[model samples]
Target chain A: MATILQFDFPYPGPWGEEGARALKDLAESIAAEPGLVWKVWTENEAEGIAGGIYCFADEPSALAYRDMHSARLASFGVTDIRAKVFDVNEGLSAITNFKIA
Target chain B: MATILQFDFPYPGPWGEEGARALKDLAESIAAEPGLVWKVWTENEAEGIAGGIYCFADEPSALAYRDMHSARLASFGVTDIRAKVFDVNEGLSAITNFKIA
Candidate 1:
């Protein structure tokens, strides 16, 4: 079963292009992690939040990535991050057709 | 079971606060729809993309929101949107603890 990981983080005080640039770099790095299938990155300026949906090949891969991401975000001075990991049920929708490779 | 809905859309050419504003309005409207539990909205300027992760009470509610959202986007001249729906497997992770209502 594919693992879905979702998370959101609030930008530190007075976020701007610089903060976004840093996040972009971080997101790109996470996307390259082994077993990562795909990720959708999102940001909301007015709300001062950013997050994404990620799919991984397995639970271990997803959990590993989550730990790495959380630590990286903390190092960047980003706090108040919320994350959840989910197991994808193939029978739910056409999502079974979505594959990483 | 809680239904997870994830989607992304490229903002129409040269998007700005105007596009985001319109999307906020649409998002707020969708959140009010019955059976919707929560939604996390995101945007990216450099990438020119916006999206969110949604939790719904059931499949029918999620699908209904999708149709409405698509039509609203079309009316706003947006195109090439991507969407996927997933059934949350409670046993997969701790996601079963996340609930609507």
Candidate 2:
């Protein structure tokens, strides 16, 4: 089973192209995390927030990564992160073609 | 490129296995919708909400489907759907191993 880790935090600027540039290496690195499957980079410039929805191999990995990511962002001077982890409904998700293998 | 549709609405009961059973047919049906790539069903039982994060073929398909979904949910006595659409940042998404194909 997989888990989804969703998080967001305040980022007043550097969205879209600029954000892409700033986070490119970080994005690539997270993609290489041991249990990671994928991530959907999310941003709402007008809403003053940025985050990603990540799919991980399982709950333990998801939780571990959440702690690691939260700390990493804090080291980058982003401390007010909002994070949540969900159990991926695999049986239901397959109906929408979400890759489970 | 893909468009991301994020939405949530009040649903106080039937989470996890029960929710899966209730929404299974709807999930299968939506999977067959034109331009839909995938949807990750989400729920917060304590928070009284249910929704999904969806990836679609393009922006127009996303918006069109959002309207259609809003209408459908309303017909099911669910009228207060909260929805937002985002243009997928393909380059950055690719960096995170998102399947943009």
Q: Give the best candidate by TM-score.
A: 2
Clashes of 2: 0
Worst 10 residues of 1 chain B by lDDT: B90-99
Candidate 1 accuracy as TM-score:
0.47
Q: Per-residue lDDT tens digits of candidate 1, residues A1-101?
A: 57777777885332334444545545455646888776655444555666656767888998898998898879988899876665543322122122333
Collision pairs in model 1: A43-B42, A43-B43
Candidate 1 residue-wise lDDT at B14: 31
Could you tell me which residue pairs clash in candidate 2? none
* Cα lDDT computed for each candidate against the true fold: 0.60, 0.80
Task: Encode model 1's per-residue lDDT on B1-101: one tens digit a residue.
Answer: 56667767885333334544445545456656788776655344455665556767788998888888788778978788766565543322222122233
lDDT for position B32 in model 1: 68
Shift in Å, residue B42, candidate 2: 2.4
Write the residue-wise lDDT of candidate 2 on A1-101 in tens digits: 67777777887767778878987888888889979888888776667877877888887999899999999989989968978777666667877887743
Which sections of candidate 1 miss by over 4 Å? Answer: A12-24, A95-101, B1-101
Please tell me what DockQ candidate 2 reaches: 0.52
Please give each candidate's TM-score. 0.47, 0.79
